[model samples]
Target: MTITHRFLQIAAVAMLLGGCTSKPIYNAQENFSSNMGISENQMQRAIVTALHDRQWKIQSVKPGQIEAEITVRGRHHAEVDIPYSPTSFEIRYRSSWGLDYKNGEIHGNYNRWVNRLRDNVLKELSIDPNIEALNNLGAVKRDVESPSYFAFQEGVERATQAGLLDGSIQFYLSGQPVPGSAHHIRTVTSSRKTNGANKSDKDACIWALQSALVALQSAAKKAGANAVIDIASIDQRSLYKDANNYQCNAGTFMASVALRGELVTLK
Candidate 1:
């Protein structure tokens, strides 16, 4: 539909004609509210309840693709300055897939399962105030598939919708959680080199730092992190103890915290 779709299609075809194969893009889908997963009605209820339970009055829920931020909540009515001032809530849901080529065909698999899972991962208002549920939109770390599927959906959005994927399309969504939200927002970035996946130099060190810098920048903006240290912060002695002999045509991206905005808070 857009220039991107056209470009990607062209690129995929070009690679195929060159006797190369590209990863087929998996499709992410959002099932109706009546599906087995959490319904929009239920999600809406959960969001509203989460806000109300936390003393954050519900303002509105915009279900559109264009809005930069999705859901918007307001403080208590007492905090209302205008007819609709600062929303007390902001929730957004997006899903996408990677482009994969199999048998000379692009595969667009439906990823609604993740959408369902995401809907079910509602805020745990019951958690203690000290404990917070920090779910990064892009912070996907997992040994799992469903959640990873969801992350793929979001990644596609970044590439297609958010315009983050200008280079080759990547298969991300580790489906694991880093450690804490306070550390930073979850972001995945990659870079590839020749020499066949060496664990020593550029593939391990310089290239890693380059990718990390990109990830850090992306995380900062996407996660709204407060600040980030120099790429040197990632102890060169550790992060990439092995970089030489980088994977030939093999790409690697290190996930890191992005931003530290005051987005997540207990009710």
Candidate 2:
């Protein structure tokens, strides 16, 4: 049978089995998103629609109908930036008295995300280039690749194992008070140690991983290596490579995640 047919067959089987365990299913999906068959537009649209369906009362694009409170919340640590990653905006609703009442305290959440699933939607219009690309990509799958943080972090880890380097590598010139590399990264996941981190930590973690990668790449270039190779997946880094179990203060609200990778001789 053709690959597509085989896919349908496998899907049918999975449906018959009530779908595989969440763990395996997610594992298989991770392979797919990290490698193939994922759409950023679809992700963003689905998120927006899901939120509209759950609330917002009227859901169409009436333009002037919705009131968007666009305000400058001041210059915050321009939170680490990444490319082509998915983010979330979750609004928790609870009746002031209980779930049945409309007078409850309702609040909205805003988070940065990438290459992974998050539990909220981002209503902020002031998004970076990567985020804008994600929102505008639409329902069709677009062939694109920007940069990977996980890859860089893995390079650092590999370097450590090889006795070539030491110390935490910050991808952003973030740690150093100087303008580090102008490079950008996309974090795909993060650890639960981040107090408010829910299942959505993956997006932040991927950003962190990308940060390390860019930093390491710069370091590697300085070390005379042409490139870094064989970067580990975010899940792998979180499970096996990270030493602190993500307990330290990585940054304000950013999870304390340590990743590793290696530099290779140029081909």
Candidate 3:
């Protein structure tokens, strides 16, 4: 081949490889403003709820700041730090693992997550008055008349009495038994609902899990067990109607969820 032709061919190959390998500049910080006429507290709650909907574990929450961790498929993980005020918020990429790039460029999935999270937060911030009223009324009625309501309170009391309601319970989403343990106890469920306004499905889900855990603790105390396992959300049903179920639903103004799990004693 001629020298000129060979040089051109090598340059073309290099260009193609560079184009293929080039990474998009990572947007480390995503800024958002609330023009939906919601208060700062409401906005923060919505953000937290959005994170919860995405299964992000909240590490810490301050007046205007939140730190959360996202785990994808039990392998890939990332940390997001959100700082907010009455009018603005920022979703900042803190750190990541199992992603291809380090700082300048981030994996596409990370961007996608932050974007999706922003969308969800915005949705939660949007307000609807009629729906809010209905949700509030429903919540009030449930508190006054729902058998599950009383059961939940009773469970909380029992758990408190037994000193098992502390956030020390080991929770497993998968229905897997703890290693080196082999004793079965009864399954327990709990459910909770959130007032539609200023709350998101994520917030409701977190509350539902807390209620469910209290119920689980109550059941464990009754069964004389030490731990609960395979904690998970379940569909709302008549069987779970009296027990708070951990199935989260979000509407114009309110959010709700039901949770279920098995109480067990670890060996």
lDDT of 3 by residue, 149-249 (tens): 22343444455566657744545443343665747776565555556566544454445445556666666778877776655543322122222322345
Tell me the spans in candidate 3 whose CA falls farther than 4 Å from its real position: 1-36, 127-267
Q: Which ten residues in a row have the lowest lDDT in candidate 2?
A: 22-31
For candidate 2, what's the RMSD?
Answer: 19.9
Q: What would the TM-score be for candidate 1 when compared with the true structure?
A: 0.19
Q: State which candidate, 2 or 3, has the greater TM-score.
A: 3
State each model's CA lDDT, in order: 0.29, 0.32, 0.60
Worst 10 residues of 1 by lDDT: 76-85
Residues 63-132, model 1: lDDT tens digits: 4211111122321111111111112222332222243324533322222222222333222211111111
**Residue-pair clashes per candidate:** 48, 32, 12
Better of 2 and 3 by lDDT: 3
Provide the RMSD of all predictions against the true structure, rounded to 1 decimal. Answer: 20.3, 19.9, 15.5
TM-score of 2: 0.22
Question: Measured by C-alpha RMSD in angstroms, how accurate is candidate 1?
Answer: 20.3
